[model samples]
Target: MKNDYLFKGEDICKSFGSTQALKNVTITISRGEIHGLIGENGSGKSTFSSICAGIQKADSGKLYLDGKEYIPSGTVDAMDKGVSMVVQEQGTVGKISASANIFFGKEAMFVKGGVLNVRKMNQEASRVLNDMGITHIDPQVMIDTLTFEDRKLIELARALYTSPKLWIVDETTTALTVNGRDILYSLMNRIKEEGGSVLFISHDIDEIMNMCDALTILRDGVMTATLEKSEFEEDKIKQLMIGREMSGHYYREDTEESIGEEVVLEAQNITGGVLKNVSVSLHRGEILGVGGLSDCGMHDLGRVMFGLTKPDIGKVQKGKGEKVKNAKWAVEHGIAYISKNRDREAMMTLCGIKDNICLPSLKQLAKGGFILKKSERNLSSKWAENMEVKANSVEQFCNTLSGGNKQKVVLAKWLAKGSDIMIMDCPTRGIDIGTKASIYQLIEQLKKEGKSILLISEELPELIGMSDRIVILKDGVLSGEFYRSEGLTEAKLIQKMI
Candidate 1:
């Protein structure tokens, strides 16, 4: 008889300031099993995993690895004890070479007499990439040059290189295309075949159901349920994760009419940086969704429209002749672009919620050329209430809040500005189903209110649900365009994206 347990987390408790990130959490993982951990944003899924991987220490918890007394000091210590994790955010250094990033913190193997062998490190990286069937990336290339999706792959490769007893993947598939997902899914299975365990965390319920042997549902820092594969049901799992019976198609179901006649925003033959001669128009009250593969240039299109990325070929214009020059100009003219990386680009994470919510409309909130503090707070409060943001107070930093709350703040900030056009890029990435549902409702409301929206996302269901019209891009070119109809399906959109 063999012992089934590989690791166990007992009575885990963690906090970040007043926020209880994890509360009395416990879980057991068997060797060779893929265990799924899920929750809404701020539900403490990441926190528990971080404790196990030694990235963050739990305030109170007993961790036993291989039935031993395991207390890892750091990431290296955790890996030494056979636990490795790929975080939700990019885990590689942008300025460093891919080879250096892959071997980061474990470069002692290349050190000989106080000198590092650069050649040997690159050779090893190349070998690993070849073995993994990744040929587009060069080991010598800097990480900054790679796209967001490719950088994620590098991180995945980095973790896989260790061949640890346990692997943790957190919200990675949300950022990937189909090809990227296949690669990751295959790797998790490979680990299982070698009698290793995997801890997979994702907001994609379908993925968790299909890939996991057991599921652990977390809600408000508490373990809600832990069920075996045999007991798995989509409705049951969703109910456990959200603590509610959610009804309705998470996407818009109405055989809806488009909002207005005026073309509010237009991109004429936009050509630059993965976008080649693409043209599109956003009508007032239209929810236009752009879809594509990971590298199909849709990300660039979002940035270009927002004036963050200058177009090499054409111009993005609002109204008749107002040329969008830069981000500042875009904001001044009532255009709000919510980036996919909310923490990185959209939110001022360290600042107070009031500041973030009042930022875009500070000029409007001013009295006689000076922004009144009372007006700012009021504006923030009004929008926060409208968006139903859950926060102790407007004084809390955006970074300290959950993913859903952070997104609400972002929306509140823009809504306060009364922007006519809102460009939402991956608006609900990594958030819980409940949060996703709220966002979809908000998008629908925005369209009905006669605001033009360019909804860009990697998730197919989101495109299918929210978009009045879906534009598909393939390898930096316009591949296909489909309008909202009874016959439109994810398969049709995917056929064009590939």
Candidate 2:
């Protein structure tokens, strides 16, 4: 690759209502390079990228693109000037079709006077979909009809259509399956081959280490260090970003703990949309990990167990009680479900943190049909503190928090309810290292307290590390079962997953 400078940022600064988001961060990229950006949540990585991509303005910074002073008014202007970003959060409209979402903000291009040319828009969108090897998604189907993974793929297609000189991808792989990731890897390689640049962001250290030629570390909005591929160290990179030594116990090192004999929860011959005669048991004190590829029906198992979906044949029983028939019954019977889609399923985005946290336990917090506000606030505050939720107050809206903070709020809400059985699905999907460590510790602590947990995850290492017992699901059935032994490995679990 040529050593020509592709872009540069000088003294980038930004703030939000007296809170400095980025503190004079600066970095550069060269042609045909995939530069990795890493930082903890609230560390200003997203802020810096948003500024560079023109989604937000920098308070005091100068940027140069191709040796010219680059200034963009908005997202469209930024894309017009050859820069595009796939934001970390969801960026598609549910009510619109996939094709319409792909061509969003540029729909005017297909307008003839006042009339929109639907035929031309669909045709172009179809061509792009074909190019991306996305044959399962219909361009005319509403995005709401698609799954979260498919919708993320649609967003990727939207960015690809821009053909920008610089692509800013922020924590996108967490939403994709293995095949989708391979597609993205190929796309990034193709961009580098064509003399374009990519600024990739992710919480997966291994991904950043393998895919990026150079790495830029950010700590609380400050540029800590930048390292070449030859200089990369897993522990050192994390140390620089968090400004401390993270204990090497990345997972729970304890293997002596064994689960109790009593069965706390059981799925007995449960048959559902994706599950067929699925039977599993969660002991009194155990972290039962369920592992598989994204489409292997493992996630559906969690939903059915939580009563989000009723089985076509059998029942989900809890603690010597009647079968749990619905979500309300499940919650009332001390079962909690932390859904993978937090924004839509877990959090009431428009409500206060206290309201969301106390939502499940309101009946217990009531007196003579009158809701006790004081009790609500106290309970929410207690668990919020326990989870180390970073919010100004319990009155703060859950929607306004960062991704990691949001996940904490969800976990806290469930933990506050004192659920005996918890179904955690991808609990730390896109969060950073420090938060991940805390969550792992929390799971371990909960197990010690005899709170049974069903951890359904796409991450194999997490399954092998955190689980007391793991079951691999393939095509909605049990493929393999493993216990927490020194002999257990990710390769063994993966062998069953496929």
Candidate 3:
């Protein structure tokens, strides 16, 4: 039976400083099946996966691959051992061609006589990308020029280039659109058909149930339960993952539109990127959802509203028609942006939580041209506690925190700033159901407090469940608008999105 397993870990224990991230955890994956690994933030899912992928070493553990002791020195070594992982955050480097990103560390393969064959590398990159059903991205173009979803696909191409026996996808589908997700699902199914295995990690229980043959649930670094497909139950799985029972829907209970007539933020014929002459308005007390496919201009609209990116034509106006000039000006005038690209745009990974949460509110925390440490600490601590950010302390670096916690820190910073208008792009992406529920509740509370929110999301269900009014964009244009009602369904939104 041990020989039947493709990979196995026994008594895995890992710690960072005094924090026990993984505690005597054990798991197994057999050949030719996709296995699900799920847990709340900081529950040791990514920690355990990192150990297997050679990105991190376990403090104490024994790992067996194909019935042999497996110890990988690093990611390259793990690749050599038939293992590769697509990380949670952005893994591709900018200012480089897509082909270079795909063959990043393995450039030696394309070097002949100490000279790199760029064309061969590009050809192989293109082949791998097309093999994985990613056809639109150009291999020769700068990676930064592509959309976030395209870059994610390039990282997937990089992982599949080696044809590893075991592939690990870490919260990757959250970044993708429907088409990109379909491509990934096809690849996972194909791998299983080819007698290979996949370690699929996600915060979405429904996705895990539908995609995996079996799943292991973790809670605070402990393996609470392992359930087969036949034993899969949403409520049971949610309880196991969070160490508590969950009931009812996390979304808003109201079905009627409730909002003020005053426009807090309005985009006046904004045009840039994929957007073309798009205009929209967010009310004073409204969760105005912006939804579309990935390539639609919804994300650009969020950036424009926050003044992070200026529109080529037209302008975004605040209360009483004050034009948003730049991000600094927007922040100064009580506007906050929670970017969909959280790791890159919303956080400084090397900075501590205190710095991250106190950054946007520095002006408020300062007096007599000097900022007091106590003031900063008080502000950061209050918001961090409010957001329930999990860290050893506020001094812990952002990079060391889990995905959901990192997002919490981002939110904490903006909340501490006390902004009245927030442009949130995929705010709950890659977050667990428990945290998502809390965020939904928070959004509703913010609306009650008369804060306007521009909610941009690829999840149609989210828009229908949370928004006072929903706007659908297609090919960079406003295609449809619908008010909150029981008739609002994903099918109705999809009709506009496509």
Candidate 4:
């Protein structure tokens, strides 16, 4: 039997100035099927989706919806034609209530006789949230007060409210917890049962294999291959996406070396909103991994250690015998922090890669009480090459680089400063396997140099594989500690956390 196609794009091409982002790519989505798109950074997954959602127009090609030619000039135009997208970076208004954000662009629905109807909108919003299995958030509460994971759920709920025939979800699950992901998976199943098509994009291939009916692979702005469910394998997918087999050595080999005698950082009796009476010690030449479930206070601990947020009662002692009172003090003490919100906290989007990399190390680049142009350029170019940042040039704007490359730049900036203690919060959050491996190698190199690291991450495997010692935080306190020699496992760590 022949399958019906809900959406089809043939010979689609798009370019940004001289750089071609998509090269004669073709894709088709069938009704009631969840189609997965997999690729490395800058492989056109996001570009193709943007074109489908009407955020950008294809330079050349044809797009057909339900066997009819369709081309939308903007997102509103696409929505009017039963197409909607849930973005990864979040596009909702933070000052408004959750209900208002869901129905923001379609406010006319709540208008009656030239007057707004708040009661009707709230009732409908409650139903929509319930359909997505979200219960903790109130419809009347402002969006800014919600957590990042909750805001992600709201984006999905808003797309569902549109009653779209074609739903595009772009890396939306990265922020969600296990239970939240289950809710989203159930919602996708319901949509499929109603004969709706979904285009799911995620860096996690495991999720794509489990949820998608078929997979499309792109590499270097070209469609590499497409595979059916019967042909799905994690390694095979990785090979296709990167155009080579991955070494599978994500973490450094365990050399079983003892931590140095020197203490790099120490936190005493830290008390914050989600952290209470927290005390931890990090030594030189050590990678300390902090892990726990969502809301377990691990993230808060990182912030307190970095001095991004001052603890109500606590002290951070640095290697220089100086106590850090705030972020400025931390920086002065050779402490560098890479936040989880890379785009918002770690990067300067409008600046060039050279500027971004050299920003954190400006103190060293200045000569005679003025910035040295030649020194800055030499430093940035050297670090960019060493980190393998794939950009046209160091002068290229950071906003134009891919997610993995941007993350590399963020790391480069901190490494350039030669910081003694580094606090990495979700450093590999949205990067691909190849880039993640590079980061792991870099971390190992830093450890070999005797620099201390506090690695705060949500992935259990990463914590177990990389950290010399694993510290589990729960309810604003340290629950358990596991040494690498003791043989740490996810199940045991989780049991301790609960």
Candidate 5:
């Protein structure tokens, strides 16, 4: 058993100001196995993984790698000690080439005579990306030019370049598409086959069951259980992680709710990005779901509908024939967009919660052409409390919150604007099951209030469960459409997606 173990964290503990993230948690990962770490948001999974990966330090505890005391000064030091991590949020820096990002910390290898060998770095990066089964990306292209999923693949490529003995993937799959996920799964399997260990964290239980040989559950910063493959059970694991037996269905039970006949939003002959002559409409008081393969243009459709991206030769119009001009226009006209790229596009992370929530409603909260702090506090406080954002106060920094909390802040900002037409693109991505339920209930309530929602998601189950009508996009075209029915299934939806 000693020889089988590759890594161990003994009595690990971590804290942030007054909050205890990890409380004397202990875990171990054996060689050549994918070990899962799962919990609700703020359950200290990322904190522990980051500590092991040397992005941060545990306040008190011990870490052993290969039966040796391991202490890394930083991420680069960790990589040198045979550990690498792909973080939960975007890790790749923008404004640089993908090649530059892949060899970020190891630039000394490509530098000689006070000059960096750009060509050599590109060649090596190209090789690493191809080896990881990511061939579509150009190594020389700017990283920001790529989509969110492609950037995640780049992060995977960066991790693969290290060829570490242990890899820590922190909730990374939430940003990937189906093809990207397949590539990631292949990489994890390859690592195990080559006698390497992987620490995989995700909110998705089914994924953990399918991919991990063993899993450790956490709740409120304490280790709940460490179960082997034979002991893996969905209900049991969920109960342990959340500390409660999940009683009702995750999604809304009502499937036969009627939607208003009025068409609130429409995309007419839209053709841009990955979309080609696509047309769709959102009815008043309806949840219109868009689903497809990870590059099928459904995400782009959401952006276009929200006026973030202008179509090449088409128009997005409100029910009253008002052309959706741009983001400002969309917001002013009671249309709100919750972007899939939450960290970058949705809320301002560096800013406080009050500012983020009150941003879109600035004009509404201002008096005499001056925005008062009290008005900001009042409006932000109301929505923050309504959204149940767990933070010290409305003035708390957005960056300090957990993934689920950050998502709630994003939703709070939009809801504070009092927008009736909501375009939520992967709104619940990377969130825990508990938060997902809350958001689902919120969506249903919004629908009841005559709000139209254009829900764009990669998860078929989510689309089938929440949408009044589901549309599938395949290779930049609308392949099939289905009205919500008892017979609707993921298999039926997948057939059209592929």
Candidate 6:
């Protein structure tokens, strides 16, 4: 007998105004299986999954649960039917305690009559965290105090607590470290063993191939193909997903010459929490890539260099000018940072695309003690067009844009500022191949213009492809450095990082 499908979507059609986001798409997820969704940017993967999780309704589709016709009005209705989604952007209140945030909506589980049961909530939260192997976090600690990776784990734990039969993870692993990813993978295996289903979405093809039983490809809002494990080939999957052959060289060629004599930025004896006695120099017209396993202090180094965090005993000197010790100082000194968490640190969701793109350049665009709307719009329009930001217009709100477009808008904002020094933290976290190519081109252009960039990314291929020099950090120390000219390999970098 054929296996019973836990969830099925047929003839799904979704539209955003005049744009058809999903066109006649159909997908079936069987119980006790992990279904991997692979697609390029703008490919209706997120939209279809969102519809499955009842975050949005499709224009035309028939959904079934246990072979029964099902249509949910909203997320709450979906949750009632044992469907839940952990989105890429964290959906938790940061100022609240972890326990409070975990059980925010389900207060009845921790509330008695008119009083809140803090101890019960804490106990339940602790149990959930422990089950997920998250030992560093305390239930009573504020969510704001936790790292991005930890907060994401907390979100996963919350989703698991819902006892979801079908769990949708949308690009959730981009923030997680190796250990955190392992925990999630183990949980997924357990969930599968317990007869639960998962819709796994990510840009990392290797992870999908390793963990998923089947793969579904989407492109231009259309379902292209679905392949079983036996038919899975990385190149074929890429071709079907993007409708084109993927270049093996995702990284840039090391055709650029050696660094010039000018030192654009330098950090000496930097001693911050998780970063000890670190020193590095960034030259003009060079891309300096920082890499390591998560917890290697590279992230903290980026934060410190961009002046987001203070260093205990270090100085960031720009050119021959004064040293920067804070974010404001970095900004004033023509230094900009694109954070790994684009939603939280980069874009303003409630604002318009034009506003988001021009935000970093407001001072430059101001005139006569007043903000110049025309200049802002013109500047934003130029960058939007150049960056190929897919939006109806600059007037469109950023929250309505896709993940890739939002990232481009963030990059446009910083590029509009014309910063001499840029510290990009995972700028392509959830972007598609096309957008990633565009970003690489932009970086190349910046390098040609003699700008200095310090790139901190988790994706090793990207670091290898784009950096003129790769710096590997391990346990709060600079463990190794490789020049692109010297032919660095993943093995060598991993060896140093570990």
Top candidate by TM-score: 3
* Per-residue error (Å), model 6, residue 331: 3.0
**How many Å off is the CA of 428 in candidate 2?**
0.8
Off by over 4 Å in 5: 1-3
Query: Cα lDDT for residue 146, model 3?
Result: 88
Pairs with backbone N, CA or C atoms under 3 Å apart (clashes), candidate 6: 251-465
Against the correct fold, how does model 1 do in TM-score?
0.95
lDDT of 3 by residue, 238-263 (tens): 99988788974879988799989999
Off by over 4 Å in 4: 255-257
- In model 1, pairs of residues that clash are none
Mark the regions of model 3 whose C-alpha exceeds 4 Å error after superposition: 1-3
The digit string of per-residue lDDT tens for model 1 on 1-498 reads 125888899999998877788899999999999999999888998889989999888899899889896899999899888999997666788788999998998899999999999999999999988877788999999999997778888998889898989999988887676888899999999999999999999988889999999999999899999999999888888888888987647888876546577888889899998899999888888999999887898989999999999988999999887889899999999999999988889999999999999998878877898989999888888988898887778888887787788999998899999998999999998888898898888888888788889999888878878888889999999999888874578889889976
Question: In candidate 1, where is summed lDDT lowest over 10 consecutive residues?
Answer: 253-262
What shift in Å separates residue 81 of candidate 6 from its native position after superposition?
1.0
lDDT of model 5 at position 74: 93
Q: Candidate 6 overall Cα lDDT vs. reference? A: 0.87
Task: Predict model 2's lDDT versus the native.
Answer: 0.88
Position 391, candidate 2: lDDT? 74
Question: How does each model score on TM-score?
Answer: 0.95, 0.95, 0.97, 0.96, 0.96, 0.95
lDDT of 6 by residue, 358-435 (tens): 887788888988998899889999999988888889999998888898998888888888788889998899887767
lDDT of 1 at 152: 86
Q: What is the Cα-based lDDT of residue 404 in candidate 4?
A: 88
Model 6 spans > 4 angstroms off? 1-3, 255-257
